[model samples]
Target: MADHLRDRFTAFFQKNVANPVMRRNPLQTLLETTGRKSGQPRRTPLGGSRVGNEFWFVSEFGDQSQYVKNIQANPRVRVRLRGRWHSGVAHLVPDDDPRRRLQSLPSFNSFGVRTFGTNLLTIRVDLDN
Candidate 1:
């Protein structure tokens, strides 16, 4: 019941406010995953770290996130970093400790994830050359 309400609230907030703001922010990172139902490209703003060829991020809603579900349907994804897009393959790392992973990411994003994230899920995206 509580989870349901949280989901509803989050959906409303993201759709009505957060997403629009993030989309316009030059510094914000965006994740592109195929839509599960529509099979169309879906872009979602996010925050994470890039190490070597891998991009890592922790989803606040975990599998409950629409993008995460899209990843489940198709692992292929794209990430926009520093104003450019990179193709990648997303890997869900349930065994990886999300709280620990957050420490290695950007501090501002990490703070929000730590504070608001409910079902944290670690995702690693292996970028293409």
Candidate 2:
């Protein structure tokens, strides 16, 4: 499939199917980024792991992801991990190897990301203590 077509299809499935289900699960990890245009909090269910005071994840669509665009607009964000919310600053690490980073994250999500992601990008969130 062409990248644009795949992206569109995947985004549709995620928005209409996957995300709604995931968001309802209290155990699901979530990233809340301010809407770049609307200025409202937008919660996106994600798969990642917390290490020390930082949380790391790979964006399946790189800068093309809506949350990533929001991060570019406003780096300050909130993350919900294991049912607790933490405030943080989000950063896009273009230099990081997303494929290698995915190896360190949850296998299930990494699998989906690797399968559907066309342009993987690494994201790091420095959590507030």
Candidate 3:
């Protein structure tokens, strides 16, 4: 029941997150990770896309979100996108190129700064090849 409630809560927030994109498309990715300190699973929902070999997650808001730090400490991430789940590791771009390019893409926007304030990371999700 708890997980069900959490899912509903997440869905509710995703609808009310003041996003013009979600207003049209309600489906997005929920990136789950392990908290470095708590050692518990933490989930962050965002509007993102998949690149060649990795998944790109961006959030212009929620600058102080702990999930970002968790990913920094442990890049391994599990993502649920459009009902399909994928597991991989993410590496922060720590530069402007990836973020700038993501912003230019039609799927994502300028929300990459929340992770590093313009230092957008090209989170390289390591997949099982």
Most lDDT-accurate candidate: 2
lDDT string, candidate 1, 28-127, tens digits: 7999999999999998988999999999999998998999999999999999999889999999999999999999999998997787678999999999
Candidate order (lDDT)? 2, 1, 3
How good is model 2 by TM-score?
0.97
Compute each candidate's TM-score over C-alphas: 0.92, 0.97, 0.60
Model 1 stretches astray by more than 4 angstroms: 1-4
Task: Show model 3 residue runs off by greater than 4 Å.
Answer: 1-26, 59-64, 104-122
**Window of ten residues with lowest summed lDDT in model 2:** 1-10
Q: Which pairs clash in the backbone of model 1? A: none
lDDT tens digits by residue: candidate 2, 39-112: 99999999998999999999999999999999999999999998999999999999999999999999999999
Best by the TM-score measure: 2
Please give the clash total of every predicted structure, in order.
0, 0, 3
lDDT of each: 0.92, 0.97, 0.59
Which is better, 2 or 3, measured by TM-score? 2
